[model samples]
Target: MTQAENERRGNVPPSNKRYFYRTYGLTIASQLELPELPKAEATSQPDVVVLTPGVAEKLEGATFRKGWLEMGDDRCQITIEGVARYRVEDGQRILLDRRVPREVDPVADPGDIRLFLLGSALGGLLHQRHWLPLHVSALKTPSGVWAFTGHSGAGKSTIGAWLHYTQNWPLVTDDVAVIKPHEDIPYLHPGPPRVKLWKDALAALGIQTEGLVRDLTREDKYHLMLNKGFQDHPSPLKALVMLERAEEGEAASLERIRGVEAFKSVMATLYRPEMGTEFNTAEQLMRESIKLAGKIRVYRFRRPWSLDQMNSSIEPLLHEIKQ
Candidate 1:
């Protein structure tokens, strides 16, 4: 490792406890501590490192916009309005600058900014590292790991929660699924042990709201801790389910997706599409997409918006996965 990497691996001038954590197939070291994630094993080496609190006020080449600006194909600069600014570099290093707002609550914890970093910034990092991050929730079942992908409000998290709480399928990830493609099979990495749920979705499933942490980013949304926790090891991906909301009277059903259509549909679910653009990963993404589509079973899963239909779709979905 280089001197810079050595500094990142706990040789930097210190202020707080440097915490080690694992996620998305990498062991990470971060100074901005988070209590929500499990600590990494002592003997494991870090793949990425996050430096905190002193990231540059503005990146030299950045063209600041509403929230972020593209810094060429290898880097990007993003700000969280009044919270923080981040400079993500080459998929390996992240620099964060935390800010305090004048109107902020005196007791409000500013750590949420770090959470945003882990999500958006990390997504960018994965792209730079040649990993394909998808906007999907995943879980392990007897059949293997199944990925649920869709546009926002298509019930990815709700279904993941349902699979976890009701069907007893252990949660693998929520929101972003980072995949490492092998010869013909891509492996799914476990993410942070948190599930975000809308108030109505939680209520529909009879899950209690008490003591849950509110997601400040989205109104009336709560972050839930999984009872069974996350799978630390990677699991081979078995299937992809593209979720779509059907008309009120339309019954839930699953249909196979094949050939070029499957590739296009799957590509649309990339966690942050522009991240790929930044890395000039289109060619690589195309190759990976075709391989993934050809290897895994892809299905278009349509269901009503109503939660009652969820249970009815579960068994059929499992059966489809088995096939």
Candidate 2:
């Protein structure tokens, strides 16, 4: 798009001071550059544009959904009620508006709200754009990328952080892994290099939190930016591991899942999956899931929630992957 066109679309105050960023296989141009993301070389035509709040006129019947998100055919709005509101349109533009209360601490950083948008709000945008976003954290192995996925508090990020810190593996992405099937092989795109972990996970990994920053939404969780051993490029997806908590008598074990069971597990990890229904991506994702199940090995990884059990399970998991 051109400068005049951007202004007409409610992308405000177009200036030459554009910050370009690449993540999840798309280029973004914005005025306020995110410190957490690596900068991309300047691009003339960006895939997504970010602007200050201007385009959002109240949609008459928009009601808040389960995750404080509302969506229509071509647009979505995220409202943090008293904190901020964001609208993404046509999967191409995002506009943010903040609503801080008078009682908030004066020293509180406003950037935290933007970071929140970058998480769930950005995932909504990717879903609208028809990208398959998985609730996964991945590591780079000599074979390829191995993705660990499960429900919240299933230790995906914790395991990813542990592997990166102790095993010297590169973290490909944290929280969301945007994937695409190319030439019969699924590829995992790189996201932000930082891994978010709870305080308990940090303690288990022997990480000091003296200088760490807490997650904006979850105070107990913190962010750890991987300065070294961070992968910025997409890699072929080699394996999928579905993390599950071990039952009382169960020991930590990795077992293969096949056919329909593998497909169901992969489907469960998709980010903001409800939005995929509105965008008609369910069938597409289903096809991709089946193809992935057929081509790659999938495993059910069970472990007790203790740090010692988690540590012990790693070697066996690695051995299974080697086979």
Candidate 3:
């Protein structure tokens, strides 16, 4: 192991599980601590074992297993009858897990860690949906894949809810959305399709969902999974909206943008980058992720927003693309 890595693994107790923390994508939030996943024995030394701070209490009699995550989701349980054995594998690689891989960074935080996890998973099972540099939420509308980008308090939920209920569109992602750009073609992958709306918005839409709203940091926001209607829709992206509330009477204008200006705007909504982030390289990436006319555009919307206004505003843009 490198000296830097050893230093990071420092103070990790062999007998404790204190919420292992790491950051991915953007930056760590100044003050947000989350729980760590439980531990399970491995039959073989992991090819890339990440020694996170873990709770010391062993599950009554948990036994080690091979080619699996430590005591995977509840279904992966075994009685601890014997010692678990594992040997590290050769030709394995461990990544530092950067959100913007080639970009520069100072440190990693919990949010960044989450981004890293998603990025790592992108290669294995989620490869088909790997496109663009994205946040957690990506909504699916009847027209195409819709992504809302902005900093916290920018009213993404408000805009998203208005789009769905007022306009009758479906949610793709509430917190995160990945945009996968095709290598040989001009297309982005469809990451997660769902969104979280504020409680008032849910009520306004008259959705009868029952669950623990406590998980939400925003009392107004409720997580939503896209309906089956989006299951077979086109996977390529449609638009990237930077949602922000304006004073009453402010005109909601849709503008086309490119480059670094675009990157910074998109970075704001991402869950990772708790520490916050900025980009010097944005134009090409931003353009590549969404179709110039049909897929991507920026809208400075005003209050009294509704589905009708959204559709009316967006229809012209969509028609432009069709032509």
TM-score of 1: 0.88
Pairs clashing in candidate 2? none
User: RMSD of candidate 3 to the true fold?
Assistant: 14.7
lDDT of 2 by residue, 109-206 (tens): 54565566677778878877777788898999767789999998898998888887877888998878787655455888877778899998889888
Q: What ranking of all candidate models by lDDT puts the best one first?
A: 2, 1, 3
Per residue, candidate 3 scores C-alpha lDDT tens digits across 1-323 of 65333333433223222222222111111111232221223323332333233222232233433332223212121111121111111112222212121223333333434333333332221211223445533456556666666666666666666655655566554554444344342233333334556666566667755862222235655545454423322355556667655456655555656665554555454333311111112544445433433335544333335533555545543453344
| Candidates in order: C-alpha RMSD to true structure | 5.4, 4.9, 14.7
Pairs clashing within candidate 1: none
Per-residue lDDT value at 26 in model 3:
17
Give per-residue lDDT, candidate 2, residue 139.
Answer: 91
Count of backbone clashes, every candidate in sequence: 0, 0, 61
Candidates sorted by TM-score, descending order? 1, 2, 3
Q: By lDDT, is 1 or 3 better?
A: 1
- What are the models' TM-scores? 0.88, 0.88, 0.46
Model 1, range 1-323, lDDT digits (tens) per residue?
55433333334554555788888877888876766667787433578888865665566765433346556547777766555667889888888765423255422244566567778888888888877888888989878999998888888999888888777778888878777765355888777778899999999889888988788778889888663556767888888999998887887788998999899877887888877756755888888888888878899988878776678866668677566
Residue 187 displacement (Å), model 1? 0.7
